[model samples]
Target: MASKMASCIFCKIIKGDIPCFKLYESDKTLAFLDINPLSRGHALVIPKFHGEKLADIPDDNLSEILPVVKKLVAATGATEYNILQNNGRGAHQEVDHVHFHMIPKPNAEEGLGIRWPQQKTDMDKIKALYEEIKARM
Candidate 1:
Protein backbone atom coordinates (compact mmCIF):
# COMPACT_ATOMS: atom_id res chain seq x y z
CA MET A 1 0.00 0.00 0.00
CA ALA A 2 2.83 2.41 0.81
CA SER A 3 4.55 1.68 -2.46
CA LYS A 4 1.34 2.15 -4.35
CA MET A 5 0.74 5.41 -2.50
CA ALA A 6 4.21 6.59 -3.42
CA SER A 7 3.44 6.05 -7.09
CA CYS A 8 -0.13 7.39 -7.04
CA ILE A 9 -0.59 10.95 -8.31
CA PHE A 10 -3.66 11.58 -6.13
CA CYS A 11 -1.66 10.43 -3.11
CA LYS A 12 1.07 12.87 -4.02
CA ILE A 13 -1.46 15.66 -4.34
CA ILE A 14 -2.88 14.79 -0.94
CA LYS A 15 0.62 14.85 0.50
CA GLY A 16 1.38 18.31 -0.99
CA ASP A 17 3.93 16.92 -3.38
CA ILE A 18 1.83 17.99 -6.35
CA PRO A 19 -0.19 21.19 -6.29
CA CYS A 20 -3.95 21.17 -6.91
CA PHE A 21 -6.87 23.55 -6.68
CA LYS A 22 -8.13 22.03 -3.47
CA LEU A 23 -11.79 22.48 -2.57
CA TYR A 24 -12.36 20.35 0.51
CA GLU A 25 -10.40 18.09 2.80
CA SER A 26 -11.17 15.82 5.71
CA ASP A 27 -9.31 13.12 7.62
CA LYS A 28 -10.52 10.52 5.14
CA THR A 29 -11.08 12.35 1.89
CA LEU A 30 -9.99 15.24 -0.33
CA ALA A 31 -11.86 17.20 -3.01
CA PHE A 32 -10.22 19.26 -5.72
CA LEU A 33 -10.80 20.81 -9.12
CA ASP A 34 -10.04 18.69 -12.15
CA ILE A 35 -7.12 20.12 -14.16
CA ASN A 36 -8.75 18.93 -17.37
CA PRO A 37 -12.36 19.73 -16.65
CA LEU A 38 -15.35 18.61 -18.65
CA SER A 39 -17.24 21.68 -17.48
CA ARG A 40 -16.63 24.90 -15.61
CA GLY A 41 -16.95 23.33 -12.18
CA HIS A 42 -15.80 19.79 -12.76
CA ALA A 43 -14.12 18.32 -9.70
CA LEU A 44 -12.95 15.09 -8.17
CA VAL A 45 -13.48 13.63 -4.72
CA ILE A 46 -11.00 11.05 -3.57
CA PRO A 47 -10.41 8.92 -0.51
CA LYS A 48 -7.11 9.59 1.29
CA PHE A 49 -6.33 5.92 1.46
CA HIS A 50 -4.56 4.26 -1.45
CA GLY A 51 -7.13 2.12 -3.18
CA GLU A 52 -7.27 1.24 -6.84
CA LYS A 53 -11.00 0.54 -6.87
CA LEU A 54 -14.12 1.18 -4.74
CA ALA A 55 -14.17 -2.35 -3.35
CA ASP A 56 -10.53 -2.02 -2.27
CA ILE A 57 -11.28 0.93 0.01
CA PRO A 58 -12.51 0.57 3.57
CA ASP A 59 -16.04 1.81 4.34
CA ASP A 60 -14.75 4.43 6.77
CA ASN A 61 -12.44 5.93 4.14
CA LEU A 62 -15.33 6.11 1.66
CA SER A 63 -17.76 7.83 4.06
CA GLU A 64 -16.66 11.39 3.26
CA ILE A 65 -16.66 11.07 -0.55
CA LEU A 66 -20.38 11.60 -1.21
CA PRO A 67 -20.84 14.37 1.35
CA VAL A 68 -17.86 16.23 -0.13
CA VAL A 69 -19.24 15.73 -3.62
CA LYS A 70 -22.62 17.02 -2.48
CA LYS A 71 -21.00 20.06 -0.91
CA LEU A 72 -19.07 20.72 -4.12
CA VAL A 73 -22.27 20.56 -6.19
CA ALA A 74 -23.99 22.95 -3.81
CA ALA A 75 -20.99 25.30 -3.70
CA THR A 76 -20.67 25.30 -7.46
CA GLY A 77 -24.44 25.93 -7.87
CA ALA A 78 -24.72 22.98 -10.20
CA THR A 79 -28.31 21.93 -10.77
CA GLU A 80 -27.46 19.08 -13.09
CA TYR A 81 -24.43 16.88 -12.65
CA ASN A 82 -23.22 13.34 -12.90
CA ILE A 83 -21.46 11.63 -10.00
CA LEU A 84 -19.28 9.04 -11.67
CA GLN A 85 -16.96 6.36 -10.30
CA ASN A 86 -15.27 3.87 -12.56
CA ASN A 87 -13.65 0.63 -11.42
CA GLY A 88 -11.35 -0.85 -14.04
CA ARG A 89 -9.58 0.14 -17.24
CA GLY A 90 -12.33 -1.49 -19.28
CA ALA A 91 -14.83 0.70 -17.44
CA HIS A 92 -12.91 3.91 -18.40
CA GLN A 93 -11.02 4.30 -15.14
CA GLU A 94 -7.84 6.03 -16.28
CA VAL A 95 -6.28 6.54 -12.87
CA ASP A 96 -5.83 3.51 -10.66
CA HIS A 97 -6.75 5.34 -7.45
CA VAL A 98 -10.39 5.34 -6.44
CA HIS A 99 -11.89 8.77 -7.15
CA PHE A 100 -15.35 10.08 -7.98
CA HIS A 101 -15.93 12.67 -10.68
CA MET A 102 -18.42 15.44 -9.99
CA ILE A 103 -19.12 16.76 -13.46
CA PRO A 104 -21.55 19.66 -13.69
CA LYS A 105 -23.64 19.39 -16.85
CA PRO A 106 -24.37 22.99 -17.69
CA ASN A 107 -25.28 22.19 -21.32
CA ALA A 108 -25.62 19.41 -23.82
CA GLU A 109 -22.09 19.91 -25.13
CA GLU A 110 -20.48 20.10 -21.70
CA GLY A 111 -19.77 17.75 -18.80
CA LEU A 112 -19.84 13.97 -18.96
CA GLY A 113 -21.40 12.72 -22.15
CA ILE A 114 -22.39 9.09 -22.28
CA ARG A 115 -24.16 6.61 -24.51
CA TRP A 116 -26.13 3.76 -23.01
CA PRO A 117 -25.77 0.73 -25.16
CA GLN A 118 -28.76 -1.21 -24.00
CA GLN A 119 -28.63 -4.94 -24.32
CA LYS A 120 -31.53 -7.25 -25.08
CA THR A 121 -33.10 -8.33 -21.80
CA ASP A 122 -33.75 -11.95 -21.07
CA MET A 123 -35.96 -12.37 -18.01
CA ASP A 124 -34.79 -15.88 -17.30
CA LYS A 125 -31.12 -14.93 -17.38
CA ILE A 126 -31.75 -11.73 -15.44
CA LYS A 127 -33.67 -13.59 -12.77
CA ALA A 128 -30.95 -16.22 -12.43
CA LEU A 129 -28.22 -13.57 -12.19
CA TYR A 130 -30.18 -11.63 -9.58
CA GLU A 131 -30.73 -14.74 -7.53
CA GLU A 132 -27.07 -15.67 -7.71
CA ILE A 133 -25.86 -12.21 -6.67
CA LYS A 134 -28.49 -11.92 -3.92
CA ALA A 135 -27.46 -15.28 -2.49
CA ARG A 136 -23.81 -14.20 -2.41
CA MET A 137 -24.72 -10.92 -0.74
Candidate 2:
Protein backbone atom coordinates (compact mmCIF):
# COMPACT_ATOMS: atom_id res chain seq x y z
CA MET A 1 0.00 0.00 0.00
CA ALA A 2 1.05 3.60 -0.64
CA SER A 3 0.82 6.75 1.43
CA LYS A 4 -1.92 9.34 1.00
CA MET A 5 -1.36 11.96 -1.67
CA ALA A 6 -1.40 15.74 -1.52
CA SER A 7 -2.79 18.21 -4.10
CA CYS A 8 -4.87 15.48 -5.70
CA ILE A 9 -7.77 17.10 -7.58
CA PHE A 10 -10.34 14.51 -6.57
CA CYS A 11 -9.30 14.65 -2.92
CA LYS A 12 -9.52 18.44 -2.97
CA ILE A 13 -13.00 18.16 -4.46
CA ILE A 14 -14.02 15.75 -1.73
CA LYS A 15 -12.64 18.11 0.89
CA GLY A 16 -14.67 21.03 -0.54
CA ASP A 17 -11.39 22.75 -1.31
CA ILE A 18 -12.18 22.48 -5.00
CA PRO A 19 -15.56 23.15 -6.52
CA CYS A 20 -17.26 20.51 -8.69
CA PHE A 21 -20.69 19.60 -9.94
CA LYS A 22 -21.30 16.97 -7.35
CA LEU A 23 -23.99 14.37 -8.09
CA TYR A 24 -23.63 11.96 -5.18
CA GLU A 25 -21.52 11.35 -2.07
CA SER A 26 -21.19 8.53 0.40
CA ASP A 27 -18.84 8.08 3.32
CA LYS A 28 -15.96 7.14 1.06
CA THR A 29 -17.05 7.87 -2.50
CA LEU A 30 -18.21 10.79 -4.62
CA ALA A 31 -19.82 11.27 -8.04
CA PHE A 32 -19.74 14.43 -10.05
CA LEU A 33 -20.49 15.60 -13.56
CA ASP A 34 -17.50 16.06 -15.79
CA ILE A 35 -16.74 19.68 -16.73
CA ASN A 36 -15.31 18.44 -20.02
CA PRO A 37 -17.88 15.82 -20.75
CA LEU A 38 -18.00 13.52 -23.77
CA SER A 39 -21.77 14.01 -23.69
CA ARG A 40 -24.20 16.28 -21.86
CA GLY A 41 -24.64 13.93 -18.93
CA HIS A 42 -21.17 12.47 -18.64
CA ALA A 43 -19.91 12.09 -15.08
CA LEU A 44 -17.08 10.74 -12.93
CA VAL A 45 -17.37 8.59 -9.82
CA ILE A 46 -14.39 8.22 -7.50
CA PRO A 47 -13.14 7.06 -4.16
CA LYS A 48 -12.85 9.85 -1.59
CA PHE A 49 -9.39 8.56 -0.85
CA HIS A 50 -6.63 9.10 -3.39
CA GLY A 51 -5.42 6.13 -5.40
CA GLU A 52 -3.17 6.92 -8.36
CA LYS A 53 -4.20 3.74 -10.18
CA LEU A 54 -6.84 1.03 -10.14
CA ALA A 55 -4.52 -1.46 -8.43
CA ASP A 56 -3.69 1.10 -5.75
CA ILE A 57 -7.35 1.42 -4.73
CA PRO A 58 -8.79 -0.50 -1.78
CA ASP A 59 -11.47 -3.09 -2.46
CA ASP A 60 -13.94 -1.27 -0.20
CA ASN A 61 -13.45 1.96 -2.12
CA LEU A 62 -13.83 0.11 -5.43
CA SER A 63 -17.06 -1.56 -4.34
CA GLU A 64 -18.65 1.81 -3.57
CA ILE A 65 -18.12 3.09 -7.11
CA LEU A 66 -20.40 0.81 -9.20
CA PRO A 67 -23.58 1.57 -7.26
CA VAL A 68 -22.97 5.28 -7.74
CA VAL A 69 -22.19 4.63 -11.41
CA LYS A 70 -25.55 2.85 -11.82
CA LYS A 71 -27.29 5.83 -10.25
CA LEU A 72 -25.53 8.22 -12.60
CA VAL A 73 -26.46 6.07 -15.62
CA ALA A 74 -30.11 5.93 -14.56
CA ALA A 75 -30.22 9.64 -13.80
CA THR A 76 -28.93 10.40 -17.28
CA GLY A 77 -31.69 8.18 -18.73
CA ALA A 78 -29.12 6.40 -20.86
CA THR A 79 -30.04 3.09 -22.50
CA GLU A 80 -26.38 2.18 -22.71
CA TYR A 81 -23.24 3.33 -20.93
CA ASN A 82 -19.51 2.76 -20.75
CA ILE A 83 -17.41 2.53 -17.59
CA LEU A 84 -13.92 3.88 -18.19
CA GLN A 85 -11.06 3.51 -15.70
CA ASN A 86 -7.56 4.69 -16.41
CA ASN A 87 -4.38 3.94 -14.47
CA GLY A 88 -1.56 5.83 -16.12
CA ARG A 89 -0.60 8.77 -18.30
CA GLY A 90 -0.10 6.36 -21.20
CA ALA A 91 -3.77 5.37 -20.87
CA HIS A 92 -4.87 9.02 -21.38
CA GLN A 93 -5.40 9.57 -17.69
CA GLU A 94 -5.26 13.30 -17.19
CA VAL A 95 -5.88 12.98 -13.48
CA ASP A 96 -3.84 10.82 -11.14
CA HIS A 97 -6.66 10.24 -8.64
CA VAL A 98 -8.60 7.02 -9.23
CA HIS A 99 -11.88 7.58 -11.06
CA PHE A 100 -14.45 5.88 -13.25
CA HIS A 101 -16.00 7.70 -16.18
CA MET A 102 -19.65 6.79 -16.39
CA ILE A 103 -20.20 8.00 -19.91
CA PRO A 104 -23.74 7.68 -21.22
CA LYS A 105 -23.71 6.63 -24.85
CA PRO A 106 -27.31 6.28 -26.00
CA ASN A 107 -26.24 5.04 -29.42
CA ALA A 108 -23.56 5.05 -32.10
CA GLU A 109 -24.74 8.53 -33.10
CA GLU A 110 -23.02 10.09 -30.08
CA GLY A 111 -20.14 9.65 -27.53
CA LEU A 112 -16.44 8.87 -27.09
CA GLY A 113 -14.61 6.22 -29.09
CA ILE A 114 -11.56 6.15 -31.29
CA ARG A 115 -10.80 3.50 -33.89
CA TRP A 116 -9.85 0.48 -31.74
CA PRO A 117 -7.03 -1.15 -33.65
CA GLN A 118 -7.01 -4.93 -33.83
CA GLN A 119 -4.01 -7.23 -34.17
CA LYS A 120 -3.22 -10.91 -34.53
CA THR A 121 -1.85 -12.68 -31.44
CA ASP A 122 0.60 -15.54 -30.98
CA MET A 123 -1.11 -18.39 -29.07
CA ASP A 124 2.08 -19.45 -27.33
CA LYS A 125 2.72 -15.98 -25.95
CA ILE A 126 -0.94 -15.64 -24.93
CA LYS A 127 -0.75 -18.92 -23.04
CA ALA A 128 2.50 -17.93 -21.34
CA LEU A 129 1.04 -14.56 -20.24
CA TYR A 130 -2.10 -16.21 -18.92
CA GLU A 131 -0.13 -18.74 -16.93
CA GLU A 132 2.09 -16.01 -15.51
CA ILE A 133 -0.91 -13.97 -14.36
CA LYS A 134 -2.63 -17.05 -12.93
CA ALA A 135 0.46 -17.94 -10.97
CA ARG A 136 0.50 -14.49 -9.42
CA MET A 137 -3.18 -14.88 -8.49
| Top-lDDT structure, candidate number | 1
Task: State the lDDT of candidate 1 residue by residue for 9-111, as single tens digits.
Answer: 9999999999999999888899999999999999999998889999999998998888899999999999999999999999999988999999999999999
- Model 1 alpha-carbon miss at residue 5, Å: 1.4
Best by TM-score: 1
Model 1: lowest-lDDT 10 consecutive positions: 1-10
**Decoy 2 TM-score against native:** 0.89
What would the TM-scores of all predictions be? 0.97, 0.89
Tens-place lDDT per residue, model 2, 1-137, is 23345567787788898999989998989999999988779999999768789898889878888888888888999877788998899899988899999888867776677678888899998999999999999
Q: What is the C-alpha lDDT of each candidate?
A: 0.94, 0.85
Alpha carbon lDDT at 26, candidate 2: 88
